[model samples]
Target: MHRSRKADAPRADRVGRAGSGALALLAIAATLAGCQRGSSETPTVPTTGPGGCPAVRAAAQAAVAQAERTDTAWDGPTTGPAAVSGRTVVFVAETMTNPGVAGVANGLREAARVVGWDLRVIDGAGSPAGIQAAMSEAVTLRPSGIVIGGFDPGSTAQQVADAAAAGIPLVGWHAVVAPGPSSRPPLFTNVTTRVEDVAGISAQWIIAHSGGRAGVVVFTDASVPFARTKSDLITAKLATCAGVRLLAYENIPIPDASSRTPREIASLLARFPDTWTHSVAINDLYFADAAPAFRAAGRKGTGPPFNIGAGDGDPSAFQRINSGQYQAATVPEPLTQQGWQIVDEFNRAFSHRPASGYVAPTHVSTAANSAGATTWDPPGYREAYRRIWGR
Candidate 1:
């Protein structure tokens, strides 16, 4: 969750694959159970690649289309001269402690290179005032745009509004709390992981593996506003599928899992003790710590109870999934990818061609599918990144 160092930018030789085709399809499918009805004016779809994956191409094209549709904060002098150059786009996060956020930052720097925008990321130290200071500095520096993915977007509306007042488009990702469901300022475009989509996919996976009925153990934080929102969503969606019951849900603030960890996990194991099961953890970080606890207590196997399902595509959880520890987990593409998309969309919006709507891609890695994968960093993105940044 820490800001990436300037020297750590992707190197010219460390290129990763650009699987927008697979990624796009994954994103679309993740976001929609079914495709949206095509408007009479719906644009043509892009052709597929050698993998015979059409969805990825379609998503890439859709991303481009999305870029075309959204408007930017700039109103005067559309193209007489570039609005800004060698400008920086700062990303302010809750705390720079998560690896997934780092991955996103890498992908974003690459994307910024494509659009000719430089990047400067900051950590919010998980505080409202810290985020405000970051935002204040960003405004003073006047970068082309700013990306804020605070732990609780609700806590920083005033600072965000202030950035808006300075004509900086504040781009927010996952877990955005809208000014209201229907109200959003032109200076902002909220982007998130599409929680319902992620939940639905995770649900589908659980239903398939668990035979439509499973007991769940939800690790949540009732005190944290964002976790509460997601915990509620996961709880309600579990009911959508038949036979799935929340056997027990523990809302222990993370790391504090020490006291409640053994007690609650042991309690759930005692109650449902079968290996054919589907459990849900808030994310990989928590899963990394707790999944093993479940396993140590003899909770891994196939039958009435099985391993828990973790979210957020966090890398550590992916490592566990690779080792045949967890059944499956979802990982967002390198945060660099999301950042790149933001830069692209920002430029488009600034140039008066904002995206209509877009979905960032995700990878659902299971033991069988993710084999031979050494790391999450793709192959071609690095080259693209180096080309953009001249690094």
Candidate 2:
């Protein structure tokens, strides 16, 4: 998080600026609280050419077109030690309710079975204390390895240290800021697409789809550093388009998303009735929660407030995209393939080899190319991993 620098000013001027800032904050708070009434008119989309930034629009269109391609080949690791058989593993989930976490866990289970390893999963129930307790239990179980699934490892520092002290190799799925081996948190490797690519392409999608003239709202979970970072990058990219207006930056935690999103969406509809042209969420679940609110507010399923999830393209996201119900696109991670990668990373550890350091490339999925699929299951990864493991 970079902070903007301010020049020195007089005390009186500073006090005046502080007072204005407070008023602005109160106004925003009132809008979010559903106290401010908004217009009932739907936002009008502009059929314009890159909003006067032709070069940016052209680059965005090219990138989005490339990302939407469905014929990407397997580019992950193809060589390593064969499976380390008969080992037991445990996956400590941030919350099974998060489709991303659960999806990866399922992939891990499938790969584990193929590699002939026993696997156990413990649900953290999406609480700090619950995750800590889960981590503690995983360390005590003394499994061959422990997976930090979709939660910050720093939050459970003691448990992670205990696992490391016990010589248990730790692998993470969206666990740390960066992918591939971390020294501070002690992860053998982290499985995730590069956050910058995901964020950049997501924003570019909005630019290309809207012809660089979108009034965008970005939703993110501030509690998770990774989610927050992605949202920030998305905001930065959206700023590149001169005609795109950032209507709002909503911070709704993932666990609370199901409960809070409906009210938030209703409020946003009232507040920015004609200006909120598009939305980009860090996860797709927000749109699922916002569906009823949108319907109640008389917003069409195929909308002016077209939504796109920046990451975690789960089955539900695909359904919404395929049906043209609120969501228009997603930058989906190869969840199942990542799960297989986790197991493969563990095998490398067991074989006394280095982490694969493989980060999946970013891809965007939309109605035109989705082909009625439920998830973005790219081809060749399963077979490639199988051959690498000699299964």
My TM-score estimates for the predictions, one after another, are 0.67, 0.87
What is candidate 1's lDDT per residue for 1-391, written digit by digit as tens? 1221111222211111112232344344323222222110111221111332233334333433332221223221112212335667888765666565656666676666665667888876555577667666766787777776544444566766777778777776553422111134333455545544444445445545554556666566555544444444555545444455555556665535555555666666666676325666555555555655667786552323444443455566667667766435443333554555466556555766544255533345555555535234333443443343344
lDDT of each structure? 0.50, 0.80
lDDT of 1 at 136: 69
In model 2, residue pairs whose N, Cα or C atoms come closer than 3 Å (at least 3 residues apart or on different chains), thus clashing, are: none
* Per-residue accuracy of model 2 over 97-149 as CA lDDT, tens digit each: 78889999999999999999999999988778888899999999999999999
Model 2 lDDT, full chain set:
0.80
State which candidate has the highest lDDT.
2
Which stretches of candidate 2 lie above 4 Å from their native place? Answer: 1-50
- Model 2: number of backbone collisions: 0
